[model samples]
Target chain A: MSLLQQLRLGFRSLMLHKLRSALAVLGILIGVTAVIWLVAMGEGVSYQAQQQIKDLGATSIIIRSIKPSEESSRDVGSRFGISYGLLRDDYERIVTNVPTISRAVPMREISREVRHREYAIDGQAIGCTPDYFGMNRLTIARGRAISEVDMKGYANVVVLAWEAARKLFPIEDPLGRAVQIGTEFYVVVGIAAERTAAAAIGGSLDARQYDRDVYIPLSTFRARIGDRVFTLRAGTTQLETVELTQITAVVEDMKEVDATADIIRSLLQRYHKSVDYAVVVPKELLEQAETMRAMFNVLLLLIAGISLLVGGIGIMNIMLATVTERTREIGIRRALGATKGEIVRQFLCETVVLAGTGGLLGVAFGFLCGPTVNGVRMAVGAFLPEVWSALPPNIRNLEPRLAPWSIIAAFAISVGVGILFGIYPARRAASMDPIEALRHE
Target chain B: MNELQPTVDREIVASIVGVSKVYKLGGHTVRALDNVSIDFRQGDFVAIMGSSGSGKSTLLNLLGCLDRPDSGQYILAGRDVAAMDDETLSRIRGRYLGFIFQSYNLIQQLSVVENIEVPLSYQRPPLPGGRERCLKLAELVGLSGRLGHRPTELSGGQQQRVAIARALVNNPHVILADEPTGNLDTATSHEIMDLLDALNRAGRTIVMVTHENDIAERARRIVRLRDGRIDTISEVRPALPVVSGSIALERL
Candidate 1:
């Protein structure tokens, strides 16, 4: 028979029992949609994670000073208020030795109570250079950030973080106002924008909360605080001295991040007797996140693949019943000069049509993933604001990115499933004895 | 029983020599047909008659090429079809034979014209003008008025007429009818038989299997079988003269 005729015949037969064919098609539709939806959601999640790592600066390396363990604190200077961790000399040595280092910012952070017209709140005072704001992705909401002149001339000026500005000033403007910090007064220059805090990543970096920080120039901090602070603890007066709590060095190119980090690590090891500093390459973390995203995609695909397998089994189940029900029809066709191969082709064509139609509908539905998720989010937010707010930021702002290859792959696999599950039933129909099949009631 | 003279002037369309078929049913082997030999000439209408378990159905199956003989040679239009593979046998059946079943085995989903077009669809070089040919065949079988009707909507007699139209659509060399009128009433049976008789008179080679002696008497020759063997092959009393040119026209 002509292929077109065979297909028409098969279609006509399937249409005779519309409910059965629809049920089979529904199985395949659910499978394909599940694959696409799950993969899209996974891609969205991984994309958010990678974006977070990229925001940490892919071409920058961070060196944080950690106090050495007691076992390694054998220096006799400890009794005389001798301090540990990275110092300003170490930061200068890095900028001088590493040719790939394009720029480096040194920061020292201390907690202090700030009072502006009786609005006293404990906040972090961060001493940094002009490049610190951009390197850490902090934006200025008002006025201007601390300038290079503020650092060079040791200007006693400060920029208040978003919440600090809100709490200290409330209805009044905080710009040009002097805020008292531990008996020292500094003028506020600018207000930083509100930023979401980043969670600690892989034990290399601590969680950073930017909303309550007070920014000051490193030169001002060195000239005023003097790196040595004495405090009364229990019954004894204890003194500690430390400088340059962290150094964030930016590389000229991403490819040099690892090599420069290695050079910095060896330089620190040569200078410091104790292992009190850690060099962290955010570039390496970005690559690790990429690998993890691939693994996540594979895991999602495997789950979707199982659903497809179940769908294939569903097709097989329905087809087997159909073959049984049409035994006499098969006999009639064979008697009507249809070859065994024609019989097989007829049944296989029906299944492929079922799966192909379902796959097409699934691809169409996959395109709706982004809007669907947004709609669901809106609904949830309207009905239960608390629940919506409780969701993680990654899920709250998820934008499903449909992979083109996944759409094609899901469709192709569904068609393959039709053929794979269709073989046995078609063979059963084809191999039937004409006389016996005709005799089947 | 062997005194009948074979018509030598007619061309032999099909013949089986020493054909036997054995069936195993529940561990008891049944010899359905044993050493049956017969020759069918072109343009001959023959009826095969037997009671229950008389090997008549088995003989019909073997002649229809639906089953193979355990040991024998079946030659059809000068080809040894007994040794042919399934694909080749299907092609032979499509090109050489047509079938009508007792149950009026028209596919219930198809219309009369679609059912008739089925056999023509399987033709390799696809019989041209299939719709026109189906319409013509429907007219020939007196079903032109109900060409679009499904089989379930038709009376038993009309369904059998559609089957007949379907059988003739392929323009096969031979028509095999298995108890063609078994499911109809006496009046409808006669109506179906009249159509068959008219087709036979138009020079179509027809082979019919029936249990009714009255039905067998309508054919020019009757072959009677009992217990897997042919009991008699005799000329039936002519109820009507062997008339030719029932419809005067060019043959397909």
Candidate 2:
């Protein structure tokens, strides 16, 4: 028989039991939807992580000073006011000795109270060169950031972070206004824009919040603070001296980040006797992120495949029942001169049609991932404000990213499952004895 | 019987020699047909009648190519078909034979026209003008007006008419009817028999199996089976001149 004719026959048979056919289609629909929805969510998460790593500067290496252990502190704290950290000389050496490093920005920060006419807040007083602003993706909202002339001339100018500006100068113009930091007065030159905090990436890096910070020239900081500060405790006084807290070395090319980071680490190990610093390469983290995304997608696909397998089993069960129900019809067709292969083809066609229809519907719904996720979040926010507020910021702001391959792969697998599961039942129907089938009641 | 060959004349449409079919019901073997032989010529209307389990149905099944004999040589249209495989049997059935069942065996989901097209769809070197041919057969079987109706929507006699149209749609060499009137009322049975009689008179060979003697009498020859063997073969004479005159008036 012509394939078209067999398909027509198969369609009519499936239509004879509309409820059963619809149920089989529903099984496949759920499976395909799960595959698309789960993969989209996974892609969204991986994309968010990779973006955070990229924001940290994919072609840069960061060296941060950490407190040494008690045994190592004995060698460093023997002389009072002799602190251990990234030195100013070390930054100069990295810039001059390392040919791969295109630029190096040194920064030092200390927690201090700032006062602007009785509106006082505790904020970090930061000293950095001009390249620090662009390297950290910090934008200036008003006036201008720390200029190279300001650092070279040792100008006493400062910039207020977004939250600090709001706290200290709520309704007043703060730019060019005087703010006192630990008995020293500095002029506010600019205000930094608000930025979302980046999440911590592994144990090597800590979470960074860019708001509520004060910026000034590194030359001015050394001249004013003098690299010596004494804190009065409950009974005794502690004196500490630290020149630079961190140094960020940017490479001309992304491929040279690992080589530069290794050279910097060896340089620090030779200059500092105690282990008080860590070198972090963002390039390595980016590679790890890519590998993790691949593994995550495969795991999600396997889980989705299991659901589709269950859906295929449902199709096989229904097909087997349909064959039993239509034994007499099969006998009639055989008597009308249908071959065994034609009978098998007829049943297989019905299953493929069921799966194909379900797959098309699933792809249509898959595109709704973004809107659906947002709608659900809005509903939760409206009904359960407390629960919504408790969710992590990442979850609150998640945007589902639909991967095109998931749509194609899920659709192909569903149809393939239909054919694979259809074989046994179709064979059973084809192998039935004509006399016995005709006698079936 | 083993050495029997085809005769020079090609008028014989089918011949069977020493065909036996054995069925094993659980552990016990039942001989459905035992050493039976028969011959049917072209343009002949024959009926084989018997009681239950008398092997009439078995003989019809073998002749229809729905099954094979345990041991025999059966020839149809100058071809040995007893040992043919399924694919060959299906092609032979589609090309050279048609069937009409007692229950009207029409597919419930299909309209009368689609059911009529069923056999033609199986023909290789596919027949063109299928819809036109189906419509013509529907007119021939007096079901042209009911071509779009499903089997369930038709009466028993109308359904049987649709079955007859389907049987003739492929224009096969012979039509096999198993108790064609077994499920119809007497008036409907007579109407169906009249249709068959007209078809036979129009030079189409037919083989029918019926238990009723009156029904068997409609055919030109009646072969009776008893205990899995042919008991007697009888040739029914034509009707008297009065009946012939009535038939002639009816034809007018």
Cα TM-score per model: 0.86, 0.88
Error of 1 at A46 (Å): 1.0
True-vs-predicted CA distance for residue A129, candidate 1, Å: 1.9
Task: Place model 1 in a CAPRI quality band.
Answer: medium
Interface RMSD of 1: 1.2
| DockQ, each predicted model | 0.65, 0.59
lDDT of each: 0.84, 0.85
lDDT tens digits by residue: candidate 2, A75-134: 778557448788988998999999999889999888789889989988889999888999
Q: Pick the candidate with the highest DockQ.
A: 1
Poorly placed runs, candidate 2 (over 4 Å):
A1-9, A67-85, A110-125, A137-142, A160-174, A178-185, A191-214, A223-243, A272-275, B1-10, B237-252
Error of 2 at A75 (Å): 7.2
Query: Could you give candidate 1's per-residue lDDT for residues B37-129 as a string of tens digits?
Result: 988876678899988899999988888888888999999989989988888777777888999999988888889999998888677777777
lDDT digits (tens) for residues A1-441 of candidate 1: 666766677778889889988888888888899889988998887776676667778898989877666567657257766577788999999999999999999999888888899798898989999899999989999989999999999998999999999999988899999998777899999999998765345353434667779999999998987687687879988676778788999998989998999999999999888887778777787788789888988998898889888888888888889899999888888888888988898888878877877788888888888899999999999999999988866678788989888899999999999889989999999999988989998
RMSD to true structure for each model, in Å:
4.2, 4.8
